[model samples]
Target: MTRTWTIAGSLSVEPATQRTDLLAEPVAKALAALENHREEAGVAPIDPELADTAAFCEAYGSPLAASANCVVVSGKRAGEVRYAAAMVLATTRADVNNVIKRRLDVRKASFAPMAEAVELTGMEYGGITPVGLPEGWPILVDKAVAEAPELVVGSGIRGSKLLVSGALLASLPGAEVVEDLGKV
Candidate 1:
């Protein structure tokens, strides 16, 4: 029997393992690497044009509070560059300037340029997720997001979204649950 996902959105979800074509290459590889944990994630197709958080939630019947957004940030310290992924709820914004800057221990930190982020992650713009990032990159999951029952997040492609439990997200490689990582 096929399992039904208890996700909040009106999206039609299928096990990500069974719909590899809807996922970006890096996302498929990462999910495959998860092995036993892969079953906990599900994917749903969407109109690529509605990839943005607000538009997606409004059009797909997913509550904004049940969606998570991932952003890539870069900070330069001395001569080396440090990069990290910040995952926060759609209802809140990542504290990039204050929290992430300090966490990266750089003089300053800012969102990575769109071109650079897409190139580095091998994912489309606006569809970047914490999964499949560079092996050593830190993934900061906001406390609120980490506590959610389930969340809709980018699937590395604008054509689909992933439905996953917060615990699953918090357990991804290099994920760290940080308090107050997001701000209203």
Candidate 2:
């Protein structure tokens, strides 16, 4: 399948390949797992220092609206802990206090601690994405995200970013498109 890249000035994106040497282990594994779906996904190398959404968008000339942020949220219910990955546009914030907490059927929901999120997902802080999250964890994609043509997201590490189709992201194994999942 031919992959389309909507890269900004001077940024080059290439098909995501099984390149463990180039990416973090979890990222490489996630890309490999996505092969079965035959979806078009690309990886663009970036300066690790500019991996944060705002910095990355500025450095790469990418629009903040086209960049998605994946946040890990956790809640407890019946003495059991539940985790979920929320994908929202950079312009908005995940409605963790309301939507997510309600969805998880827990009294409260909050962003997972950076160390816990990193350890659980095997991804670096500031670079945890929904694509390679642990099984049984739901991936909640905001309606806007699911409707976008394309988006830039984390690649499980700070050294690169993944460019993917929004529709494809919504179709991931555990993804669910939720209306009003994000709030300004």
Candidate 3:
């Protein structure tokens, strides 16, 4: 089935009904990189409000538990790169030291501040996803989250997102399945 969605306009509109591209701008860049790196995964666009975990649930008529949210982590002591992308379920949080940080080879790691994350991702603070990162950062998904029916991820642009199966997402772009990411 070819999936499609309509964006619920930003917080300032009245009974806002607007639409934009499915794959948000930032997500588009990430897909291009993955494609360039030879990732075979494809991203589907959806209404921008669906970009949020809860909004995604309501718009797609799916449980929020099934949505996949991607967070861009900055200041990862993971190598000298200092930045990374951490993809996990709304039900969980990325483990910093014991797993993620260690894996990234960073001595210290923290979620990038909202402003920094926004500037780097080129998307709003709550709208970052792994689909279109600036490159170099790795995408780590919780193994459990990897099993949901469909997940909502940023579309690279603030105006859209991709709704996909956790399995398909993992298969696409070869997302890594990691254990120990904390369940929240």
- Number of clashes recorded per candidate: 0, 0, 15
Least accurate 10 contiguous residues by lDDT in model 3: 9-18
Task: Identify the runs in model 2 with alpha carbons over 4 angstroms from their true place.
Answer: 18-20, 35-39
Candidate 1's clash total is 0
lDDT of 2 by residue, 1-184 (tens): 5566665445677776733554567767766787454347777888999999999999989999899999999999999999999999999999999999999999989999999999999998877888878988999999999998888998888988888777868978789999999999
Candidate 1 clashing pairs, residues 3+ apart or interchain = none
The alpha-carbon RMSD values of the candidates against the true structure, listed in the order shown, are 1.3, 1.7, 6.4
Q: In candidate 1, what are the lDDT values of residues 96-145, reduced to their tens digit? A: 99999999999999999999999999999989998788899999999999
Model 2 clash pairs?
none
Return the TM-score for each candidate structure. 0.96, 0.93, 0.69
Regions of candidate 1 where Cα sits further than 4 Å from its true position: 1-3
Q: Give Cα distance to truth, residue 10, candidate 1, Å.
A: 2.7
For 71-163, candidate 3 gives per-residue lDDT tens digits of 666554324557767778777777865676776677777777888877876777666766656655667778876676555565555564555
The numbered model that scores best in TM-score is 1
Indicate which candidate wins on lDDT. 1
Error at 85, model 2, angstroms:
0.3
Residue-level error in angstroms, candidate 1, position 164: 0.6
- lDDT (0-100) at residue 181 of candidate 2? 98
Worst 10 residues of 2 by lDDT: 1-10
